[model samples]
Each structure stands twice: as structure tokens, then as C-alpha cells.
Target: MAVSDECKIKFRELKAKRSYRFIVFKIDQQQIVVETLGGPNQSYDDFTSSLPSNECRYAVYDFEFITAENCQKSKIFFIAWSPEISKVRMKMVYASSKDSFKRELDGIQFELQATDPSEMSLDIVKGRAI
Candidate 1:
């Protein structure tokens, strides 16, 4: 699917203004890492521990993460968008697998960020910022 112009613009703006951080964890006895960018500062500050091992398929080495008290209350997912195929693929899983947490990853999303500003484009952008 083609990203909206507004989304593209917002994505660009985020690319220019946001700072990204990564977190490694495991679920179901599986190891996965999440790399998140933007959102509130607390998103990175409120994490208690790493996620458990689960099925993750986003990046090869690193993922995305944010530290927020509110976000901690749910199972977060890392999905990648493929402009060539017009679809979003779930690559990494970030969820609070603890029964006490009882939080479902709602509204959790991602976009690919380009290291080079010139490479930022729908055709080039893969996943949300991370």
C-alpha cells in the first residue's frame, strides 16, 4: 500500500526530530529485540525488564523500543511495511508476557527509517522509525 502524503510528511518530520532506542528481550522462551523511536520520553524510561522470547522477524541484529509507563501495560509488536508488496509484516514481537501485566499491545506500530536523508522515500522506506 502507498503511504499517505501526510504519513510520508509526518514520517519525514519524525525522522528529523526523533531519537531512536532499542531494547532486547525474550518471550515464550524466545529472544527478540525491539527498536522504537519517538513518542514520550518516558517510553524509554519506564521499562522494567526485557521481553521474553517469541517469534520476531523485523531486523537482523537490532529492533526498536520506547520507554513509557502507559505503553508498558500492553504487548507491543514490531511490524515492517513493504511498499513493493503494499503490506505490513510482523517481524518482531514486544509484549509483556507476564500474567500480572495483562496488557495487550494495542496501537503498536513501526516504520522503516533511512540512515541517509536522500534515501527517504516510500519505495525505500520499509518499517516505521526505529
Candidate 2:
């Protein structure tokens, strides 16, 4: 349940500098580590596609869209992706460690926990954004 120092630094870069579109994290031998990073120019589809189909992962997405008032807006979403098809042990680890891991990253506007693709749909994300 250890959070890497790099995770905090990378998250800070993303939130303060808009340096990344998304970040995918995985637990490597019990320590959470960065798995992949999507550049600032990457699309939401790219972020969604980066997630594995049957694995547990934590991610942060810098979401941008136009508000109903025709103003540009952004939100930082913290996501916990735990597919039902993934291993029970993996799910337990992620669920148990989520709060502690999240506490290390500040300025997260929203949080979403998805057990499958549909649960973490684009529409659901937008709903939270609003």
C-alpha cells in the first residue's frame, strides 16, 4: 500500500502544468507505480483505451469540455478501475488502499469507481463534471 514519490510529483505536474492528459497506475510487487502516461494532447478515448480489460488500476484524467454557458472548463477525475473479471486479490488490494493512495494527490475534483467499462462511461464522467 505504499505510494511512490514519483506518483506525487507526476500528479502535481499534471494538475499544475497540464503536462498529461491521463495517468495509469498499477501495483508492482505491492508498491504502486506508474504504468503509463498520456500526453496533454491525447484524447479521452486514448485514456480509456489505455486501461486493461481485466485488471485493477488507478488513474487520473484531466477532463476538459465546454460548459453550458459556452465557457471552457476542466476537472481532474480520480478513477478506480476494478473490473469484475479481474482477480479478487487485486480488487481487495485496490479497494483497501484507495483512500490512502488518493490522499497523497491534492486537487482532485471528482472520484469514480468502476467495476466495468459501462460503469466508467464518458457520460458518467461528464455527469460528474457538471
Candidate 3:
């Protein structure tokens, strides 16, 4: 699907913030699905493995994350399951110094509460709560 203009704007704003990492999502039918990509280190293996058989219909890995600087990003990963979304969409928001990345990730848990996947578009942008 084509990305909305609002989502483009929000993405630009997010990039400007230069945060370490963030997850973007959208509500699909009655379930929320990750709108971003995942990789070996960032995969939602644990979460997906724990789901009931009927709930495990989607692919575990839907996106690929690529970065030029590996040393500067955070290796820390977090997992959370909300009835809000049925999948994970964790990703690095920017590439910068290690210290800056760490600082940005420190407060992300709190910020995540404000994210409403229902408001987000399919492209993971143009969300009202973004």
C-alpha cells in the first residue's frame, strides 16, 4: 500500500528526534500487527512461540533490518504482548553514537504506552498517537 502523507511527516519527525529505537504497528482486523521489519537479533521468537496454535497464522519474520554501523546501536531487546497488537515491530530509529542510542532507548518503555496502533496506517506511519 502507498504510504500516507501524514505518515511521511511523522517519519520525518521521528528521524529528526534521532531516537535509538521504536516500534510501529497497526490494527489488523481485531489484532494489531507489526508494521516494521525484524531480524535474527530483533526477532519475536519468544512471543510467537508462546502463542496458541490458532493465533500463530502470520509469518514470524516479516521485515529485514539493515544498518551500516552495528557498533553504535543498542543490543538490548524488549518484548511485550498487548491485545493491542498480535505482532512485534521493534526497530532502530536512528544511527548515531552508542551513548546517544542508549539514552534514547532508556525511556522508550514509557513512551510506548502512548502509541495506539489503531491510529497508525499500514505503512506504520500517520498514526494519531505517534
RMSD of each: 15.5, 0.8, 16.2
lDDT for 27 in candidate 3 is: 33
lDDT of each: 0.28, 0.94, 0.30
Q: What ranges in model 3 sit over 4 Å off?
A: 27-130
Number of backbone collisions per candidate = 31, 0, 4
The C-alpha stretches of model 2 lying farther than 4 A from their native spots are: none
**In TM-score terms, which candidate is top?**
2
Q: Write the per-residue lDDT of candidate 3 for residues 1-78, one digit (tens) a residue.
A: 222343334333334443213334333454334454333354334324433322212111122233355333322222
Per-residue lDDT of model 2, residues 9-119, tens digit only: 999999999999999999998899999999999998899899999999999999999998999989999999999899999999999999999999999999999988888
Steric clash pairs (candidate 3): 7-126, 32-85, 32-86, 37-63
Q: Mind sharing the TM-score for model 2? A: 0.97
Which tens-of-lDDT digit does each residue in 26-77 have in candidate 1?
2323432233223434333232112212232222112233435433222223
lDDT of 3: 0.30
